[model samples]
Each structure stands twice: as structure tokens, then as C-alpha cells.
Target: MSELAEPTVDPADWTCPAPLRDQPVVVMGHGGGGALSAELIEQVFAPAYGNATLAALTDSAVLDLGGARLAFSTDSYVVRPLFFPGGGLGDLAVNGTVNDLAMSGARPAYLSAAFVLEEGVELAVVEKVARAMGAAAEAAGVVVATGDTKVVESGHGDGVYVTTSGVGLVPAGVDIRPQRARPGDVVIVSGPIGLHGVAVMSVREGLEFGVEIASDTAPLADLVAAMLAVTPDIHVLRDPTRGGLGASLNEIARASGTGVRLSERSIPVPDAVANACGFLGLDPLYVANEGRLVAFVPPSAAEEVLAAMRAHPQGSGAAVIGECVAEHPGMVVVATGLGGTRVVDLPLGEQLPRIC
Candidate 1:
């Protein structure tokens, strides 16, 4: 009898990082659970998503949910121009959910996706979105334990809309929230802002600003992880998405019953995005961003957290933008670059509608 052939090992146990590069922008085929899908998950998703529960290669990640604590957050995505300059709706859905949980000082664990599709939509497009959602969840080390899909008449529903909810576990002794800000507390941004809003508007308005400007839609899990490592005593964490920094600060000020003072020079805005805002009569402060975040921390721990933020790739442009003040409680004041001051009030309505 011929000797039995050696048993073949499973691909997931190889422990080698997936090798995929030079792939063009995402397409419908990439979302299918075939070679392209595997490549996408292994290469882009697995690296940043380092966690034992997620690496199991199972349909759902089995999180030990009985840990220190849990935080739950949900958001609906109805952004027009589903496909944008730097990211599509798939990645945005994932990032938005992850950032919400991160804002609670929690490590996001599980996610649920609900899809509303317009009838006659291409199966290829739906598959692509599903694939992107799966890949995004894998990268964030979260799982889609459950999901639902509904089909609507062609004109009734937009092309597609996704609602995602996430649950996370907050480490013991972590207290990050808007109400924690004190007069001496400092404000810091994770990175450059306005990229996402400007990118989407660029595509919609068909205006090109001479150079390619893409959305900054990225997960803040790793960046938050690093910040927590340095100092878990953060005051607040928020992703300025729909309303941007102006709205976020106003919310925090009102929540904490404290006033905030910001310096225009300290905030970091890319020249291209700034120019776009100027041309369109848009204030960069109120423009949306997917990848950036704002943090409030005690004055003492501010430098440490800022250093940790700057060392990370996503927060390379991080800077301390402002500080809480005792005067003008529940308001935000901005010291302009031209030796003037202005109230950075929340816009009564959407400044750049559908930009997110």
C-alpha cells in the first residue's frame, strides 16, 4: 500500500501575514469570499486587528464579554455619493461604529450590520459592500454576530444604506467622557480634519482642487489603544464626523457645563483642504472627518498622551488645539490667527449637508 500523503495544514494557522499589494481601488469582485476577499482580509484587515478572539477564522468572534465593562453605540449611514475619493460606504460604516465605541474609552468587540437595499440594485454591488463590511470588521477585531437585510422599491430607497451598532469593553479605571473636562484640561486632535467631508463634496460637486485629496476614513482602535497604554485617564474622546470640531466642542461644553478656548494656529488643517474650505465659504472647523479624533485630558497627562498620539502613524499631525476655561460656561471661543476672537458656535443646521 502506498504511504498516506501528509495531512494538509489549514491556511489560517500559517501565522504568516497575507501578501496582497498593488490591488486597485475596491470593486464588486473583491467583496466575494474568494481569493480577492481572502487577500483583502489577510493583508489589510489582519495586521491592525491583532487579537486572539478574531484570529480564529470563524464566522463570529467569541468575545469574553464578562470583562471590566461594556459600552454600546449605534449610528446610521446615509451619506450620498456612496463611493468617495478615499473610502466607500463600507469602510465608513465600520470606522464610524468603531470610533463611537472608542469615544467611550472602550475596546470595541462586536458589531451588527443592517442593510436596506433598493430593488434592482446590482448583486455585484451588494456583494462588494458585504465584503467590505466583513473586511472592515475583521480589521477592527470585531465580529458581525448578526445582521438583517431588507429590499425596498427602487425609488423608495436610496442605492443602499447601512446601520451599524457596536459593543465594546472598557478597561477598568478608565474615565473618559465629555463631563470630565475641567478648566485646566487640554484639548488635542488625533490628526488633520476636513478630509472626509471635502473629499465627498469634491466628487459630488465635480470640482477638483488641482491635487488629489482623499477622505481620512480610518479606524482609531490602534491609536486609542496606544493612548490608553500611555495614560488611561483621558477626559473625553470624540470623532468629529458629521458636525466636525465645532459641533463636537459645543456638545462637550454643554455636557460638562464648561467653556472652551481654542487657538486657530494650534489646529492642524491640510493646505489643500483649507483652500477648498475658503473657496466654498466653508469653515474648516465645521467640516467632517472620519479618521480624526479630539481628546481632552488632564493638564498633567496631556504631554504624555500627545506624545503617544504623535508617535502613531494616524496621529502624526496631532496637536494641542485648546483648553477648557472657567468663563463663558457651555460655550467655545476661538482665538483667530489675525489677533481676533470668534465664537465657534454650532451651526444651526448642516453647513455641508450630506458631506459625511
Candidate 2:
């Protein structure tokens, strides 16, 4: 090779990529759905005013209060455009917090909404968003028990941002947490991955794909109830929202001190999503999802839990994509269709911004 020739790249010798770690202040990646977000929590937030609940970092904090178990969570939505195919920010706000509670094997019961509005935004827009929230809560059979609103100067805020907090009851004999994942646990995903992120990007960025992809933003409380019916001993349930399946699984691996092995072919990626991600140099595994969940269950109850999941409307497309392993603890690996193995690491930064 001549001195002027370009260097060859080897995909096999992969390393987790990120910007230099010496950044003094904040960058977009700090809010991005990846390692930077986790770092912010671990390095800065967790160490201050911390408790065991935040340390676990599960979907929601399962608390034992007054002899009653409760799952509590909160989420804020700043999705650009406010509206997209299949849903809007209002619906996303309600469903996101509800799903977080549901992941803890709780039946979501009530939510509180708070809004931050820009000064120049129209009243009609706020009502439309509020109406959407009302309808979504009704559909999920949950209630918006309370709410508050405030306004910001036009330039200081998005048109509208919503924050929601929820509380739900956990049934007796039901315990679920990421740290409970074990070596023989079966890993299941509720449905196709990458739809919600792509749906938002396609509309917000005006990217053209042949077919329209809709966001998969729906509530999952009932679907969780179905799985609990099969066995109350289920180990882990995590919604693959920000940072997608890869980040969710990686978190579980680290929390449980176990390894995760996935089959490339078994992980479902819709053709449209795959093409869009490939063209954009994005990995669907690392994309965001609004309505999908990943579960870890003991081998003895894998089939029963899978069947229960598939029987629910929210889980009709559920599939077993991998298993918890004892090898390479704290890492995730995929066996490719071409007979090669590759490591899947928690993304160092967000691949797409404001995806959820």
C-alpha cells in the first residue's frame, strides 16, 4: 500500500465510541439515551441526596410503604413536533410513566400531569394536548388524578413540555427487579424494535422511506397483568424506551453481574426500520422505543410467560431473542447470522436526539 492510501477499518476490533471524556460542563449526550445519561446519574446525581431506590435504577422504584407495596415513577416528555404518526406528546407523557410503573409488576392506577408552556403558544394547542392525555388515560383504564401548569418565556421553552408522575400497586408474592436476572433466564421482547424512534425521525427530519412507520406508543399495564398470571416469580421486566434494547439489556447485565447472549436473527427488526437505520448508519438495537418491553424469566417458566405475553394485545408480537448467560459477565454479545460473534455495548452517546 502507498503512503497516501487510506487506512482499512476492521469491524471485528470494535470499541465503544464516544466524545472525549474531559468535557467540563454539559453536552447533548448528557440528556441523550445512552451512557452519558447513566454517567450523569452515577457520577453526579446518584452521589448526592441519594438512596437505595435511585441506586437500583430500575424502571420504577418499588417501595414498601405502610405494609403495602407500590411502584412509583416519573417521566418528562419533550418530543419535538408535539405530534407524530400514531401518537402525540400528551399520549406519550401519560403512557411513558404508566409503562414504567407496569414494568415493576404493578397495575398502574393514577397519574399526575404538569405542563411547561411557552409564552406565545396558543391555548388551543394546550387543550389538544390535554385532550389527548385524557383519552390515553381512559384507554389505559387509569386516571389523571391531579395536574399543574406553568409558562416560560417563548425562547426558553419548547412549545409544550409535559411531566407525569404515577403510582401503582404491586400484588403480593410478586417481586421483579433487574438485579434478579439469573444465568438461565430467558430474554423476551414484546414486539418489533425501532418503530417509535423511526416514526419520530421520519416525520421530524423529513427522511423518506418507502412505507410509513408508526410509533408504537401504548400502555402495558394489562399486558403485565397477563404475564403475572402465569407466574408471580418472574425475574425482570424493563421497557426498552430510551437507548433501546441494547442499553436496557446492558443495564440488566451490569446490575445482575451476568452475561447476555442474543441471536442476531431472532431479534426482530422491521425491513423499513432496518433499511432506514442502515442508510443512516444507525444500529436498530440502539434506537429508542416507546411501547416495547424486555423480560427476563427463569428457564422453568419461560414458555409459560411467553405464552401469557403473546396472548395480550400489547404483547402479540413477543419473541424470545436471547438468554442470560454466565460468560463474559457484565457484557452483551450477539451471535450473527454469518457465524460471527460481536459485542453489543451500551451506546456512549445518543444516536438520535429527542427520540422519546
- Roughly what TM-score does model 2 have, to 2 decimal places? 0.93
Prediction 2 global C-alpha lDDT: 0.90
lDDT of 1 at 105: 76
Candidate 2 has its poorest 10 consecutive residues by lDDT at 11-20
TM-score to native of every candidate shown: 0.80, 0.93
Q: Each model's C-alpha lDDT?
A: 0.80, 0.90
Deviation of model 2 at 194, angstroms: 0.3
Candidate 2 deviant stretches above 4 angstroms: 1-21
lDDT of 2 by residue, 53-102 (tens): 78788888988899889899998899988999889998899899999999
